[model samples]
Every structure is written in C-alpha cells, then in structure tokens.
Target: MRIRATVATVTAAALSAALAVTALAAPAAGAEQDDTPTQIKNIEVNQNRDYTVVVEAARKVKFPISALVHDPSGIKSVSFSLQHGATEAEVDGRIAQVGPSRCVKVDESWSKCEAVMIADPYTNVRSNALAGAWGINIVAVDGEGNVTREDYMPLARIKRKTHLSLADATPEPVKKGKNLTVKARMIVASWEKHKDVPLIGHQVLLQFRQGASGPFKTLKKVRTDRNGWATATVQATVDGQYRYDFAGTSLTQARSGLADFVDVK
Candidate 1:
C-alpha cells in the first residue's frame, strides 16, 4: 500500500505540469489563427482635373484608399505618404505627410480613406525632386495590430505660368467692310528645360467688343503656328477692342490680358 500511494502521487504531479503547459500554449495558437490578413482594393489619385494626375499651380490633391479589413476588431487608422520615388526613404525632404485621416466605413468589413495633399507652386517649381514621376504609399492598420500597405505611381507634372500677348490690331484706322488682321503670340512653360518656349499648335480665340464698355463677342478661332503666332481676319464694322483668349490645357491654365482697340471709319 505504501508503494502504491507513492506511485499515485507522482502521476498526479506529472498531469498537473502537463495541463499548465497546454493552457499557456493554447492562447498562442488562438492568436495565430485570429490574425487575418487585411486586403487593399480600388486605389486612386487625382489632382482635380477629372481623373488626370497632373499638378499645375497650387491645388488640393486627393488620394483615396479602399480596403477590406478582415480582423474582427475593426480598422484603427489609415496613413498616406507622397514621395518622388517608390519608397519613403528614397526621397526624404520631398515627401509630404498625409494624415491618418478618418476612414468612412462603407460596410462591416470595408472602409475608404482620403488624404488631401497640398501642391505648392513655388515650392514645387523650385524643387527638382517634384518634377518627375511621383508615387503614393497607403498603410492601413487594424485594432488587432495587423497592417496592410500598398504603393502606387501616379503620373504628375509641375506647371509654370504662361505669357500671352495681343499685338495692336494692324491698320488702326480702317474703312468699313474691309478685312482687318488680328495677331497674337503665346509663350508656355517648357517641361524639359527651365526656360519658357513658344507654344505651338494651340487654339487662340479672337474676341471683339463693339464699344469701349461693351461685352466681347467671339469672332473666330485660329491655331498657332511653329512661331507661336496666330492671325485672324475679320470685317471691320465699328470702333471696338480686340483680344486673344488662349483656352487652358491639362498642363497649363487659360490666359488673357488687356485688349487692343481699333477704329473703323
């Protein structure tokens, strides 16, 4: 009976130690299974010109990240970084910090977040780092500490102010019903170099005002030649002011200045 009692005591002690180890290991296994990978989908970037990503002048740029977080604890935050290259560390000073802004919950497991990036004209024009291909980084985190990150390269370009000039209408004093010539020139920013160059193949509108205080009416449209010069001919009817309007493009803004006056006898 004494030997049997000692054997029973040893078996009980071994069972207790095994139970303690199993209890500790169970939580770790559960943790591994609970970690569900987050999914990112339907990402977009824009600079306020429809879906175009080109940036000209100072404007509010937007980056939207759509994601489906699989963790049961829900999403915690979403962060964005705008940089010149693929990675943040590749371009240090050029990177713009976009906020871990509030994500709008679309459904139980899906959300969308937007980050507004400010493009400063002066800062971008001066920095060579901002002129080329730029990228955005999106990071999403869940309450359970699971993280998902994605990278995208959005085509972008920095623009400069264009110079437009309308020369005085040739033949200042002209007879009624005679054709009068309107001439103008446009100078646009060059992306390849720092200097501005003559803008070619752009449409320029010729507008005429009946009198000094009257509204201007569109007379005709003329395309600029290789020399950045546009010419249009209109029949002189009365004393009026003439000007050229250059409609903007994806890379530049529309421009018009003071009009040139002409007298008809």
Candidate 2:
C-alpha cells in the first residue's frame, strides 16, 4: 500500500506541472496582435497645407510639425526627418532628423505628437543643395515594438527670399502715346553673405495701373540683364503707376515692387 501511494503522488504532481505550463503558454483575454504596425495620420507642418520655407539669410529658421498616430498596442514614439532627395543614395548625406517628441494621449489607441525643424542654411545647406522642395519623413513605434516608417512625403518648399525694386520710370512727365522706359532690378538673399545679390536671366513683369488704388495690369515681361536690370519700353497712355512684379521661380519667392507714379502730359 505504501509503494502504491508514492506512485500516485508522483503522477498527480506531473499532471499539475503540465497543466500549469499549458496555462502559461496561452494568450490572455482581450489581447491584441503584437505585429500590428503603428499608423500615422493628419500630418501638418506649421498649420499650412503647402508650407513654403523661405530662407531669408544665413540664420536659423524654426518651424513646428505635428501628426496624429494610432496603434492598437499604444504609441511609444514618433520621429521626424527632413530630406531633399527621394532615394536612399540621394539622401544618405543630406538628411536632418528631429528626435522623438512628447506625445499627448488622445485615447487608449491614439496620440498626438509634435516636433520642430530648424533649417540653417549657413550650416546645413548641403542637405538637398539648400533650395527647392523638401520632404518630411516619419517613423512611429508602438508599445509592442512594432514600427512603421514613411518616407519622402511632401512637407515644405525651401526657396530663397527675393525682392523686386522699380528703380525708375522716365520720363516723369511724358506726352501721351510716347515711349516711356521703366527700369527695375531683381535681387535675392545670399545665404553666405547675408546680403542681397543680383538674380540675372530671370523674367520680370512690367505692370501698370490707371490710378493709385486699382488692380494693376501686366504690360510686358522682360528678362533681367547681366546687371540684374530689367527694362521695358511702353507707350505712356495716361497718368498712372508703374511697377515690376516677379511671379517667382523654383528657387526664388514672388515679390512685387512699390509702384512709381508718372504724370501724363
């Protein structure tokens, strides 16, 4: 009877150990999939749909970026990167990254994250040649270690700040129906010198309005010369204002010069 009791106790202990192992291996109730990736949504940079970054000088310019993220396992981090090119080979040496920012919890499954990008042309202009359109890259991680990476999304355009100045309109008092010359110059901000430099070989529009307060009409388009000068000769029809307008290009910003009033005799 004693030997039979010892064998029964060993069998019962073995059965209990197997049952405990099975319970430990099973998933808990209401558990989520550990492989689900975090989702990114509603990304906005500086609250502008088409945010244009104009580098005025050799200084640093800062802007805010925000996004909404969702994950079943909860959000761990959200990061941002500013890139110039599309492929990895193109952006390998020209990328700017902002580390994970504080995220505000919206719910059990969603969070809002915010970050800032500082564009310094004097220091980091090598990133994408320091001009034209740039993209924003995003990477999100969930509580379960699942990650989601999005690359090369349209975020902002980096352009050089420019100005148009109407130098002169001569003759000041000219007879109606006579040829009048309008002179202008186009200059852009230089990142290295922090000064205005000539922007040559660019188109500038000569615009005229009948009065001091009215819609102006484009008279003609003239290209800037080697001296950054754009000149147009038009018939002086009446007493009005003349100005130069730059519609902007891929690397420069649009600018309208102050009007120069002329009296018709």
Of the candidates shown, which would achieve the greatest lDDT relative to the real structure? 2
**What's the lDDT for candidate 1?**
0.60
Q: Best candidate per TM-score, number? A: 2
Clashing pairs in 1: none
Q: Which stretches of candidate 1 lie over 4 Å from their true place?
A: 1-77, 81-137, 146-161, 212-216
Deviating ranges (above 4 Å) for candidate 2: 1-33, 92-100, 106-108, 126-128, 153-155
Q: Model 2, range 91-189, lDDT digits (tens) per residue?
A: 432335455587999999999988877777666653325677667766566665444566543456777889888558998799999999999888887
TM-score, one value per model: 0.52, 0.79
- Kindly list the per-residue Cα lDDT of model 1 for residues 81-120, writing each as its tens digit: 5556444345433445445566777788777766655555
> Each candidate: what lDDT?
0.60, 0.72
